[model samples]
Target: MYNLGGSVYWNRKTFKKWFATRPINLKWMLLVILVFPMFAATWEMKKSSGFSPLQLLGLLVFAFAFMSIISKKTKAPNLFFLFYVFLFLLITNLLLVFFYEGSFSQFGDTIRTILPFLLFFYFRKHLNSVIDIEGFLITFLIASVFPISTLYYEILFNPIREVYNTASRGGGLRLSGFYADLFGYMSHLICGFICYCYFYIKYSKRKSKHFIFSNVGFLFVLLICLIGIYNLRHQASWAVSLILLSMFVYFIRKQVSAFQLFVFFIIALGVGGYFYTQIFETLFAKDIAVYEGGAKETAALNGRVYLWKKYYAFWENFNVLGQWIGAGFAQHEKSSVMMSGGMHNDYVRFFFSTGIIGILCYVSFLIYLIKKTLKTRIVEFKFLLLASVIVILMYSISALPLLASGALMYFVVAIASQINKNIV
Candidate 1:
């Protein structure tokens, strides 16, 4: 039943013997409950009209689990922090919707989306085998490539050019992948590409049969992502790209040289200069007002700035518990004008919703995990950790849809975790 990348040695008799000997771990059981449901729900909704990222992630988890079970492996590691946050957000947000706004489903979509990561975290501690690590990483990368590729094509060709044509004041053309929206999709892809690169480089010397093909495919995927970000005309994309690229270079200084870095910087400057020139001309030119007043055209930029202001103002509302409970998960809104969603500021979000305690716990968890991971000698481990740092750094500037695509985020963490834990 399980003969894909690797084989598991388990027959009916072997399973019975293993069952008799296997110890029941409470952590493993708790994880199965929280994480497996995402997959179950995904399969139930597979044929439905609108399947969200959460659903897709759930299905992927199920597929991975099916393969794992057939191979007779124990559960994967449990990284419950994400799940804990999501659960906290869900309950708090639902209470907000039910009590304040009556928007019951407002937080439902996000809750469902996070299901996969919740499961991933639940099993984080149990991922004990190389097969588990590889399977999880491969599935994560495989799942995200398709939807992101579709977005790349749509934006690159600008087939209908709705985003550019919409003339929206705030956001450019929304590049929703298989999921319902584009920002999150793009963020997920950027993160996944970083992780993929890390793993690809780490595995380059392994001399496996798939290394050549995987490496080439990774480059192609990366190029497509780059093109997609450029076409989308989203500053968030650029911000994330810079962060991811910088972290990649930082961690793998041995692989990248001073000359290469200078060349890359020069190229970035050239491209940025070209774009800035065009924008400057459009804004300042006397006769031709392509953006009319330039104010409307740059509304998105203004809106973000405005939101940041609101975010600061809203912070005053949360004292201590506001930080602990997280101003009630998901988002903390001040006035209708200054609405907060997606926790644009991670530190703010952490402080407001989960409180200082939660933030400290999370930070402590990361520091400890990072310290543990740093001890591993695996080159892949270092690269993966660097990529994770890249993704986290990007989140500071833009909400990179960490929750939208569970596999993408989870894989990045898992790959890094496995490497850190010496599982990979």
Candidate 2:
């Protein structure tokens, strides 16, 4: 039944054994869950309903995942799960016709919200296979070609900013790549950075296979991750970068001498200060202008303070029930900011999209994750899980971390590891 994602041994009787119903192969499913969709961003040919490669890939994942729940066991839990996805698709289509006036953009918005949660839920349930850290990291790097290639394409081709999918802001061309916006691409870069550093750290400990971690190629990929994040240049990016750097340093604290560290920082300061204007101006260009206006609160947050005010007022207007349960996806998108996918805050996004009840569920799940993180004995797995949580919470303040697969996938992997002691 899980043939779609599980591996099958090949032999003379392979064809005869193909019909055997296998349990869900957790690792391959993780690969598919991690790889597709955003990878399809490199070839998004249409904005209309059902034409997008992402939409199609998302539908396939939803369908297969739900069906796996059904095929695994014919019980109340599985049936309810199957019905939920079907009902969502039905309501989404109906809402598109009436509430959204046939807007595929709204259709796209609704599906994106649903996919991430389903991906997490499915992985969390099938726990045994999530332990393949090395194999998964390799898969992640291979899948990264989709978004990373888009970065180089933009740099090499220099497409017209006016018409192409290129994202630009603050007089700088962002490395958004094939993603429709900067947040998604930047979020992926955050994941890439972790994977690259993981390989580098592993290789430095001892000699290893070329495919797992290459010394020369590792540096190249690491550089790309940093450069892409630098070009994207969001306030959230800076926060995430500092968090990542601090985490990395903390992990390798015992490996380096004080003199080595001092020299590293001195060289970094010298190189960065050498082109002070170019780097500083490019990074803080918009913030500088906003600060000059004397709007200290707004400047500090890049206008999120203002946006949050409006959202607060709008949310206040919700009735007792609406405030508790949320204004469904289609109804919530009536706000222009939401339709364009710019809440500038995940709490605000959650309030509008899922309301108090959903928020509680999310927060509770987070607590459970923290407990699991504490229980894990594996040092490396523990660090990855904790870091994923830190990244999500940090990005939550200024960006939509929940929506990014990069931010959520590792957490899902962490959950899988906690269930099995020997996964690594």
Candidate 3:
């Protein structure tokens, strides 16, 4: 189409010549750059109730196309860890229908619930460049503040009128930020911490100019998450965070040094202890207007023990075969005068919806994921993801947030997939 230093006709052939020089990988990075905003905005839309089904559909289609580009490289999905759990969910639901005559609504709920996992597969395929991937992650966490900040502002300043009328509601003054519910906010906060901790560890080695900033961000996010968990008064969340942080330290002990780790734990414990008093006084005090019997009300730890007991009873009723596929989820909906809700436990939800066979399959899949992550090369990143996975598992014991926070769990798994690939 062109001669050396000669006038060339601008045509498709000439365009192709120019395009061929650009790297295919860069194209994928560019796709991420373009898509990041859409994802960020979508999270915001969920808060505002602003997005339409059509818009969401379009986003999913674009995501699929983006993932398709990467899928060409690998013959099989590298994300079998995630897919297996998905298969568990599907098989469980089908079994429920066959045995328990599960509701048609369960199918709709299941599909909507699993969409994040699909998007994660897309993320694993399309994320080509470190810069692009990291940039999108950082942006998502940063933009999450929009919803968080607004909730805090409203709680502190405007104060929800209904909240003022209901004394039991007052203790939940903890800022949810952008998340829809208390658990949602805490879960996303944990995810943010994973990103913060991993990136801090990763970049600290390179002595990059951004190292200080990363450390500062890590401290900030960790503090916020800890406080957020405390404010949430979710016993499971606090326990999970402590366990995961312990694991993070254990995983990094070789690199961080014994004295440094000791100091880190001391500082963390001191900070958490200091805030414990404030949180207790503010959220758990009997004298407070929000006190619906103080310790008794706030002390139920979100009624987790009760929830677990109920689910246990339900589990006992099921036979070996019934336990394998579950009694079906929708059937568990017992509408009482006080509430029309069922068990709040994720394990219970899964068990009832799918049965024991499904639970085994799902648990096995999670174990495989952790095993794969252990095998991965990027030691720090894998550790961070593994810690987060542990937190999600433990937290899920109490709060079954299967379909919340833009399906962040899947995103975690997708990022873990990348870690698995890059590690070994």
Highest lDDT model number: 2
Q: Model 3: per-residue lDDT, tens digit, 198-283?
A: 65555444433353334455566666767566555555566667776766666666655466567667766776576566544444
Stretches off by above 4 angstroms in model 3 are 1-73, 76-107, 128-133, 151-172, 177-179, 206-208, 214-221, 227-233, 251-263, 275-301, 304-321, 328-342, 419-424
User: Per-candidate RMSD vs. true structure?
Assistant: 8.8, 7.5, 9.0
TM-score of each: 0.60, 0.70, 0.66
Backbone steric clashes in candidate 2, count: 0
lDDT of each: 0.49, 0.54, 0.52
Error of 3 at 177 (Å): 6.1
Model 2 per-residue lDDT tens digits across residues 325-353: 55543344454344224776666776555
TM-score of 3: 0.66
Write the number of the candidate with greater TM-score, choosing between 2 and 3. Answer: 2
- Model 1 ranges off by over 4 Å: 1-103, 106-117, 155-161, 165-174, 183-188, 206-221, 249-302, 311-320, 323-343, 400-407, 416-420
Q: Give one digit per residue, the lDDT tens place, for model 1 in 248-288.
A: 54555454447645654564465457545644343234212
